[model samples]
Target: MMTQNLLVELLVEELPPKSLKQLGDSFARLLAASLEMQGLMSKDAPVTAFATPRRLAVHIGNVAAQAADKAVTQKLMPVKVGLDAQGQATPPLLKKLASLGADASVVPQLKRALDGKTETLFWDSIATGISLTDGVQKALQEAITQLPIPKVMTYQLADGWQSVNFVRPVHALAALHGADIVSVNILGLQAGRETQGHRFAAKINPIVLHNADSYAQQLSTEGAVIAGFAERRAEITRQLTSAAAQEQLTLIDDDALLDEVTALVEHPNVLVGTFGAAFLQVPQECLILTMKANQKYFPLLDAQGKLANKFLLVSNIRPIDSAQVIAGNERVVRSRLADAKFFFDQDRKKTLASRVPELNRVVYHNKLGTLGERSKRVLTIAKAIGLELGGEALANQADQAANLAKADLLTEMVGEFPELQGIMGNYYARHDGFSEPIAQAIEDHYKPRFAGDALPRNPVGVCVALADKLETLVGLFGIQQMPTGDKDPFALRRHALGVIRILIEKELRLSLDMLLKQAKDAFAAQLIKENDFIFDLKIFIFDRLDSISREQGYRPQEIEAVLSFLPPYLIQVPRRLEAVRAFSDLPEAASLAAAYKRIHNILEKDMKKGPMPGVGSVRNLFIDIHFLMEPAEILLFNALNTIKPQADEAFEAGQYTQSLQLLAALKEPVDAFFDSVMVYTDDANLRANRLNLLTLLRDAMNRVADLSKLAVN
Candidate 1:
C-alpha cells in the first residue's frame, strides 16, 4: 500500500514557443492517464506540469511502486467448441488451456456464461500487477510519442551515427520516484536526477534535484529557472505591470504575445526600452504589431490608449547593471521601427485609389481569378445590397468602397504586414482627402474579421462586408471546393458565419438565399453551371445560423421549431424564437403542442390514404358545421374563428409573442374536441370536414413556430 510522488523531466534545446504550453499539458496528462490505466496511480492523483524554454517536466503525487493484482475472467470459447457432447474436455480445450499456462486438471474449474445465443466457457486467473518501473517507462514512452508537437526535428545524437526525431534535440531525461531514480531510457537518454537550467544564470552547471517534490523549488534556487510555465508567466506579468507603472504607461494586453514570450524565456526580467518618438507618426497598429510579432515585446500605451514610444522587454537573464540589456533592445527596436516608418512613408506617396489597377496582377485563387476580378464582383454585390438597403446615394458609396477595399494589398505597409490590410486602406484613403464615410467603409468592410468582432459601422460598410464575405463563400462553393469536416482551407465556414452574423446582428432586411444567388450571379462567368449547389450553399449558411442560435442559449426544440418554417427573414428569427419560448411557458402549452402534433399526424395519414373524391387538397377543405354532430366540434370551430383574427392582427403588428399568446384560448376547446369528436367517421364528408378543421388548427398554431416540435411536457 506504500506510495511515492514521482517527477519526470525532458531537457532539450528550446521548444517551439507557440506549442510549449500544449506540449507540457499533453505530456503531463498522457503520463498520468497511462499510469492510472495501469493501476500504478489513483485516478485523482495530483499532478503538476512544468515547462520552460529548455525543459518539460511533471510531478505526480501518490504514484504506487506497483499496481494491484486484478482478477480477470476471459471467455475461452463456446461450451460446445471447448467440450464434447459428454461435457468433457476436447483436444481443442486442452490446447487453449496449455496456451494459457494451464493443464486439463483445471478444465472442470472453468466458468460457463451465456454469450450471444450460446453458453461460453471462461477462464479465471489473477493478473500479476505491473511494477512501477515498467509502468512508468511505458507511460513515459506513450507521453513522449503522443505530444502535440507542431513539428519534429531529426538530429544526430552525441554518438554521431544515430539520429532521433523529437520536437528538439534530447539532451537529458530525468525520472524520480520520491528520492530514488526510476531507471528508464527515452530518446537515447538515460534517466537521471540532474537537469540543465537557464543557459547563463544557473547557480550550478547541472542542478541536482534532491527529490521528486523538491524539483521545482531547487530549479528556482540553484538552477535560476522558474520551471512552471504559468508561474513564470505570472512573474513576467507582475514585472511588466510594475515597470509600466514606473513609466506612467500601460502595457498592451495580448494573451497570445504574452504566452509566446513566456515560452521564449525561463527567468523573465521585464525591462523598459524606448524607440524614437517619430515612429509614432505611423499608425499605432503597425508599430504595435512589429513590437509584438517581430520583436516579442509588449508595447506600452499612453493614457489615451495611443502607442507610447517606450515598450517593455522580457529578458532571459537578470543582471546587476541592466542598462546594456535595455539599450540593446531599444537599438534593435529602433531599426524595426525605422523599417515600419519607411514603409508607411513610401506607401503614403501613392494613394490607395491609384493602387487599384495593380490588383489585376495579383491572383486570388486559380479558379476564382485575380483580386481585381474579385473586387469587381464584390463591388457589384455591394452596390446591389446597398440599393436594396437604402437608395442611390448609399449604393454609390458602397460601390466606391468595394472598388478600393483591396487597394491596400499593394501598399508597402500592408504588403509587409498583411494583418493591417483594411486599416492601411482607411489611412491611405483619408490621406487622399476622401470623405470620412468612404474611408471608414474601406476599413469597416472587414470589420468582423473574427468571431465576436465588430460589425460594419455604416450602411455602406455593411453592404461591402456582406459582399466581401458572400463573394468568398459563393465563389469557393461554385468551384465545388465546399468545406467538408474541418478542411475549409479557404475559410468558407467563417465567411458563412460572418454573413449570418451580419444579417442577424445588423438586422439587415436581406434574404440569405437571395444573397447567395447574387453572389453566385456575380461569379457566373467562372462558376460551373450547377443547379443544386446553391441550395447546398444555403444549407451551409443555415447550419452556421443553427450553431449561432444554440450558442445564444435557445432550447434545441425551440430552435428547430422556428427554423422548420425557413422564415424568409433571418432577422426575425430571434423574435420568432422569443415568441416560441414565451408560448412554451404558458399554462396550456403542453396540451396545445401535443394536439398540434396529433393534428399534423392525422392530416398526413389522411393524405397518404388519397384525397376525398371532389377535394382538390385534403388540407384545404371547408369545415361544415352541419357535419359537426358534436357540440365540442362546433365550440372548437368557434374558438378557432374567434382567435384567428386577433392572432393575425398581432402578428401583422410585429407582436410575435402576443400572436402566440392569443392562440392559447383554443387549448380548452381543442382538448375537448379531440376527446369527444370521432374525427375519422365513416362518412367521407364528415372526415373531410374534420380534416379541414384540424388543418386550420395546424396553420394557426404554426404562425410563430411549428409548435409540434416543442416538448409537450
Candidate 2:
C-alpha cells in the first residue's frame, strides 16, 4: 500500500482578500467530489484544505499512490428492442447519446425474463478499467470547471480552447501528486509542480513545489501570508497588546471592526502610531470612528485615562520606513476626526426632542413611508410591551425612547456611519437631559444585532427592541414582503430569532398569540384595503412564530398538534420539548412503543374498510362480577381505567410526557388483552366494552405525538 499527496495553487496578482475564504471552501468541496468520482481519493484517505488571500492550497493525505483505474456500467439495449424487432435500431433512443452527450454506440447484449415471458433486453456492460493518469485528469478538469469564483477572467489563447471559460486571466496553474506533477490543462494554463508566495515579503522568485507536501510554508514565506483568518487575527491582537503596554495603554478590540479588517488583509503587520494630542479634544466616538473606519486602526486610551490620540494599525506591507507610513495614516485620520467633532458640536446645538420632526425629512423606505411615521408606529407597539411587563415607569419610558430612537438618523455623525443609527440618539438624548435609562435604551434598541450579538440588558431597552422588531415584521408582512426560504431580504428571520431569544433567555412568560395580535393591531388601520378578516392578518405573523418554534428545537408537527386545541403559549413549547426528551429516558418507553406499535397495527389493518368496531360506554355486563370471567381481563380494564384520568390530569397540569408515561404504564395490560382474548366475541356488549378501552388507549397516545411517525431506533 502506498500513500500520496496532491497540492494545487493559483498564483495570481493580488486576489481580493474578502472573497478568498468562501472560494477556498468551494474549491475543496468541488475537488473532493470530482476525485471521489474518479477513484483517486481512497476510502482511507483524508483531505486537508487551507487558504490565504493570495493563494488557495490543498493537501490529500494517505491518497492512493495512483488513482484506481476507472470503470462504470454502461447499459445498451438488446438487438430486439434496439431494432424494434425489425433488425433496425429504435429511432428515438439511438438518436440519444452518452452521459456527456456523445453519439451512442452498440456493444455486447443479453436477454432474461421471468417464467417463460417475453423479456426486454440490454447490453449489460461491465466497463473495463482505463489508465490511472486518464482518471485523475478527467477529475481535475471537472473540479476546476465547477470551482466557485466571484470574479474570473481568461487571457490565454482563447479561441481554440475546448475547455471551460473563466472570469480571471489565467497566468499559471500548479498541481502535484506526491512529488510528480499531474498532466492536465486548466483554462489555458498548464498544471505543473511549482507555486508562488507572498507578493512582498518573500523571494521575488516563485517557489518550485517538488511535491504537494511542501505547499504551505513556501507560499506563506513568499506572500508573507497567514493560512487561517483566526490565526492571523490572534497574532495581531497579541502584538497590539504588547505595543500598547509600552505607554500604559490598551487596545479596544471591536469585533465588528476586526471582521472587516480580517477580510481586508492577508499578511498583517502591526505598528503603533499617534495623532496630535490636541485632536484628543474631539468626542471619543469621533476619534474612534475616524481611526477604526477610515484607517482600519484600533484606538487606545492613554495612561491619564483620556482618548490617548494613539492607534494601532495592521498593514499588508512591511515598511523599511515604518515611521513615514505611520505619520501618513495619522494625518488622514486627524482630518476626518476634526470634521466629526465639528458635526457633533453643531448637531448638539439642537435638542434631541426638537430633532424628532426632522426625521420626516428622511426616507425610511420609498414604499413604506417616512422615518417619522415608522417611529410613531414603534412607539405605539412599545407601550403595549411595557404594559405586558407591568412596569408603568418602563411603559412611559418606552414611549419616550421610541419617539427619540430615530432622532440620530437626522444627525451628520449617523449619516456618515449608518451603523451608528441608534447609537448617536442615545448620546444626544443624554445631552438633551433625558434620564439615564431612556438615554441608554436608545442605543440598546438595536441589540441582538446578529446571531452571536448581545441582547438588550435593560428592561426599558428590551421593551423598545420588542416594539422595533414587531413593527418591521407587521409592516413588511402586511405588504407581502415576508421572507421565503433563503430570501429574507427584510431579515425577518433575524427579527423572529431575536424575539425567541429575548423570551427564552429572559424567561418571560407570555402568550405568543397575544404578542402576534399586538403586531396585527399595529397594522389594523393599514389593512383595511386588504381584508376585513383576522385570519389573513394573523397567519403571516403566526407563520413566523411557527418558523421560530422549529428553530427553538420543537418539531413543527408537535407545535401544530399542540396548537390545534390549545392557546398559543410560547413558554409551554419548550417545557413540552423538555418533557418529550425526558420521556425517552424512561425504562418503560421501549415497552410502551412496542405495545402501541402492535395494537395500532391491528386497528390500521382490520378496522378501516368494512366495519369499525369500538368499545363504547356500556360497562353494565362487565359491571357484574361473573362477567369479569377472566382475571387477566379484569386486571387490564382496571389498569387502563386508572391511567386514563391520570393522563388527563397530567396534561391539564402541562406535564405532557408525564401524561404519556401514565398512559404508557397501560402497555403491559394492552399486550395481555390482545394476547388472551378475541375481540369479536359472540357477546356484542363485551366486545364493545373492549373496543372502547382500545379507543381510549389510541386517544391518549395522540397527546404526545403521532406514535407511528416515530422510529424506535
Candidate 3:
C-alpha cells in the first residue's frame, strides 16, 4: 500500500481567531468522514490543523492512493407479478438488466419455517462504475464547499463564485494528494498545485507542493507561515522564556493571552521591553491585565518579589530599529494603566456603604422587575431555605448579603468590566461595615456560571446561591420562558447544576418539594398571564434534575420512575437509582420484572387504558382460606406475608434495593400462581382473593421502582 500524504490550505484574510480554530477542526473531521463513508481506506493519523491570522491548513498522512472500488446493490422487481403467465423469466426485466450491463439472475426463495408458505424474488441490478479520480474530486468538493462557515458573505459579485465567504477574501486554494494536484472548481476559484507565500514577507508565485511533509517544510522556509499551532506555540514560549531569563525576570504564564498572541502573528519574534518605575505603583493585577490585554505583552516579575518595570512582547517581524517596537509597547501599556488607576482612585472616594441604597434603581431583569425587587425576593427566599436546611448562620448571612449583592453592578469599575460583578460587590460590602461572612456571600453566590467555574465556598454563600438560581428558574417558569433543545438563553442548566452540587456535596437536609413551591410563590406576583400554568413547574424542574442526576451516576429511566411516585423531584436522583439498584439484586427480582413485563405487555398489546384497580390501602395481606385451593396459591399466600414485614423495614431504612431483593424471592411462587391459579377466574371469591394478592405484589414492586415500566435494555 502506497502512503499517499495530502495537504489542503485555504488562504484568506485574517479570520476571527476562535471561529477559525473551529473551522479548521471541522475541515479535518468532515474530510475524514467523507472519505470513510465513500469506502476509502486510510491509516488514521493525527490530523494536524493550523491557523494563522490569515490562513488555515490541514495535513493528513497515509491516505490511500485511491478509494476502494464500490460494489452497488439494488432490489429489482419482477416484470410480471408471478414471473409472467408463461411461468418463465420476463423478457422486459432481462432487457433492462442487459442495457444496464448486468446479467439477470434468479434469486432464491424458501419456505417459511413457521408454516409452509412459499415466495420467490429476482434482482436485475445496475452500477455506474466511478473512476477513482472522479470520486475523489467529487468528495473533496463537497467537503470544502459545505464546510460550516456560519455568517458568510458574498465577494466579487461574480458568476460561479462561492456561496460561502469568510472574513477575508480566499485568495488561493492549495491542495495536493501525493504528487498529484487535487483539482477542484469551487465558486469562481480554481484549486491547483500553485500557492503563494506570506502577504508581507517573501511574496512569491506558485510554489508547487511535492508532498505533505515536504509541503510543510517548503511553507516554513518560503511560504513564511508556521503549519502547526502546537509547534508555533512551543517556539513562542521558548523564545519568550529564554529572553526573559536574560533579564533576570520570570514571564507571567497566561495561556489565554498566549493563544490570542499566537493567532496574531505568522512568525513570532520575542522582544523584552522596559517601563519606568513610576508606573510600578499601579496594582499588580491591573498592571498584568494592562500588559496582556492592551499591549498583547507578557509581563515579567523580578526575583526581588516586586513588579518588574518590564514586559515581554511577541512581534511578527524584527523592527528596522529594535528599540522602536520595545518603546511603542511600553507607551501603550502605560496609557492603559493610567485609565485603571483613575477608575481605582475614583471608586475609593465613595465607600461601598454609600452606594448600597442606590442599588434599588438598577434593573436585574426587565421581566423580574427591579434589582431592588429581586434583592427583596432573594432575602425572603434565602431565609426560608436556610431555616428549612437548619442553618441559622447561613439564613442570617443570606438576609444580610442579598440586600447588597448587586450594588456593584452600578459601580464604575464593574460597568467598565462586567467580569468583576461579584468581586466589586464583595469589596463594597466590606466597606459598608458588613461582617466578613456576609461580605463574602455577595461574591460567592454567583459562582459556577460555567462548567469550569467554582462553587460558593460557605454555608451562607450556598443558601444565597440557591436563592439566586431558584429565583431565575421560578421566574422564567412563571413567564413561560423555558429552555428547550439547545436554546438556553438564561443559563437555567447551570443554575440547576449548582443546586445539585450543593445538595450532594454539602449534604443539605432541605426538601425540594417545599423549596420549589416557595420559589414559585415568591415570584408568582410578577407573572402577567398563564396564571393557571403553575402546576407545570414540577416538569420543568424535574427535567433539569434528570439531566443533572444522570451525570451523577443515576440511570435516567430509574430517575423517571422514582420521580413518578415522589413529588417535587428534589431528592438525590442517585439515591433513588441506588434503591432501584439494590432491589434488582434479589433472587426473585428478575421474576418480578419478568412478571410485570408480561402484565404490561399484555395490557399494552390490547391497548388497555385508564388506571386499573390495586389493593387499595391494605398494608397487610389476607390469607382468604375459603378461596385458597391450589398448593402454589396457599404457599404464595404465606410467602408474601412473611416478605412484606421484612421488606417494609428495609425500605424505610433506605435499604430499598435489599427490600427488592427480599421481595424478588417470591418469583417462583409468583410464576406458579400465574401458571396455575387464574387471576380473572369465574369464581368471584377466588377472583377477589387473587386480586388482593396482585395488589399486594404491585405495591411491593412499586416500592423499589415501577418494574412494569422498566425497559429491559
Candidate 4:
C-alpha cells in the first residue's frame, strides 16, 4: 500500500515548435497509461505534463513502488487428455505442468471445471509484481516510441560511434520515484537528476530537481523556464494583454499563434514594436499576413479592428531596456511589410478581368481541365442558380463574379501567399470599377471555407459559392476520386458541408438534388456516362448534413425520422426535425408512430409478395374510398379526411409544428381499427380495401416526416 510520486524528463536540443505541445502531451499520457495498465499506478493519479523548448517531462502522483501481485486462473486441456485412464498424470499432463513451472506433485491440486460439455483442468497461481525500476524503464521506452513527432534526427552520442534517432539530439534523461533516482535509460542517456534550463536566462546552468513535486517550481526559480504548456501559454497571454492595453491596442486573437509562440520560448517578455506607416496603404490582410507568417509577431488592431502600425513580439529574454529587441523586430518586420506593399501595387496594375486569359495555363486537376474551363462551368451553374434565386440583375452579377473568382490565382500576391486568392480578387475587381455586390461576391465565394465560418452576404455571392462547391464535388466524384476513410485529399467532405451550411443557414430555397444535377451537367462534356456518381455524391452531402444535425443536439430518433425521407428542401429540414421532436412529446405520439410502423410493414410485405390484381406498382399507392366496411374503419377514414386537409394547409403555410400536431387525433381511431379490423382477410375485396386504407393512413401521417422511424419506447 506504500506509494510515491514519480518524475521523468527528457532533455534535448530545441524541438520543432509546431509539434512540441503534441509530443509532450503524448509522452506523458502514453507513459502514465502504460503504468496504470500494468497496475503500477492507480486510476485517479494526478499527472502534470511539461514541455519547454528543450525538454519534455511529467510528474505522476501516487505511483506504487511495485505493482501488487495478482491471482490468475489458467484453463488447461480437457480432463481426458491431461490424465490417464487410472486418474494418474499422463506424459502430456506432466509436460504441460512442467512448462507452467509446476511439477507432478502439484497436479492433484488442479481444479476441474466444465467448459462446453467436457470437464477441463485449471491452474491457479500468483503473478509476481514488477519493481518500480523495471516498470519506469518500460514506460519510458514506450513513451519515447509513441511520441507524435513530425520528424526525427539521427545523431551520435558522446561515445561517438553509436547513433540514436529522436525528435532532437537527446542531452540527458531524469527519472525519480519520490526523492530516489530510478534506474532507467532512454535515447542512449542514463537517468539522473540533472536537466538544462533556459539557454541564457536561467540562474543555474544545470538545474537539479531534488523531488518529483518540485520539478515545476525549481525549473521556474533556478532555470527561468515555465515548463507546463498550458501554464506557459497563459503567462504569454497575460503579458500580451497587459502590453497591448498600455498602447491602447489589442492583439489579434489566434490560439494557434499563441501555442506556437509559447513552444518557441521558455520565459516570455512581450515587447511592443511598430512598422512604417506607409505600409498602411496596402490591404490590412496583406500587412497582417506578412507580419504574422513571415515574422512570428502578433499584429495589434485598432478599436475598429483595423490592423495598427504596432505589433507585439514575445522575446525569450527580459532585459533592463527592451529597446534593442523592439527595434530589431521592427527592422525585420519593415522589410516584410514593404515586400507586401510592392506585391499589392504590382498586382493592381493588371486588373482581375485582364488576368482571365492567364487562367488557362493554371491546371486545376489532372483529369479536370484548367481554371479557365472550370470557371466557365461555374459561370454556367452560377447563372442558372442566380436566375432561379432572382431574375436578371442577380444573374448578371453572379456571372461576372464567377468569371473572376479564380483570376487572382495569377496575381503576384496570391502566387506568393495562396491563402489570399479570393481576397485579392475582390480588391482587383473593385479597382476595375465593378459593382460593389459583384466585387464582394468574388471574395465571398469561398465564404464558408471552414466549419462555423460565415456564408455569402448577398444573393450573387450565394449563387457563386454554391456553384463553386458543387463543381468541385461533382468533378472530383466523376473521376472516381471520392474520399474513403480519413483520406480526403481534395477536401470533398468540407466542400459538401460548406454547401449544406450555406443552404440551411441562409435559408436559400434551393433543391440539393437540382444543384447536384446542375453540377453533373456542367461537367457533361467531361463525364463519361458510365462514371456518373451523382447519387453517391448526394448521399455524401446528406451524410455531412446528418453530422451537422447531431451537433445541433437533435435526438437520434428525431433526426432519423426527418432524414429518412431525404426531403428535397434541405433548408426546411431543421423545421421538420423540430416539429418531430415536439410531436414525440405528445401523449398520442407513441401510439400513432407504432400504428404507422405497422401499416408500413403491412404494405411493404404486400408489395414484396407481388402486385395485387388492381394494384399496378408501388407508385400507384392510392386508396379506394368505396371499401369502408367496418365502423372502426369508417371512423378512421372520416378522421383522416378531416385531419389530412387541415395538416396539408398548415404544412403548406410553413406551420410545421401545427401540421404534425393535427395528426394526434387519429391515434384513438387507429388503435381501434387495428384491434377490430383484419388487414389480411381471406376475401380479396376486403384485403384490397384494408391495404388501401392503410396506405391512406401512411400518407396522412407522413406529411412532415416519416413518423414510423420515431422511437416508441
User: Clash number for model 4?
Assistant: 0
lDDT of 1 by residue, 1-713 (tens): 79999999999998999999999999999999999999999988999999988999999999999899999997899999999999899999999989988999988899999998899999999988999999989998898889888888999988899998999998999899999999999888999999887889998989888999999989989989999999999999999999999999988889999999999999999988888878899899999999987999999888999999899999998999999999999889999989999999998898887889899999998888899999999999999898999999999999999999999999888888999999989999999998888998999998688888998888889999999999988887777899878798888888888888888899988887788778888875635576688878888887888889999999999999998888878888899999989998999998889999999889888878976753324645577778777899999999999999899999988799999999999999999999999988887777788788888888888888889998555
State every prediction's TM-score relative to the real structure: 0.96, 0.75, 0.77, 0.96
lDDT of 3: 0.69
The alpha-carbon lDDT assigned to residue 300 of candidate 1 equals 89
RMSD of every candidate to native, in Å, equals 2.1, 6.3, 6.7, 2.2
- lDDT comparison, 1 vs 3, better candidate: 1
Kindly list the per-residue Cα lDDT of model 4 for residues 124-199, writing each as its tens digit. Answer: 8888898899998889888888888888789998999999989999899989899999988987888999888888
lDDT of 4: 0.89
Return the lDDT, model 2, position 229. 56
Worst 10 residues of 3 by lDDT: 107-116
lDDT for each residue of candidate 2 in 160-203, tens digit (9 for 90 to 100): 64444554455677878788877766666788876655566766
Name the runs in model 4 displaced over 4 angstroms.
Answer: 75-105, 112-121, 611-626, 711-713
Candidate 1 weakest lDDT stretch, 10 residues:
613-622
Estimate the TM-score for candidate 3: 0.77
lDDT of each: 0.89, 0.69, 0.69, 0.89
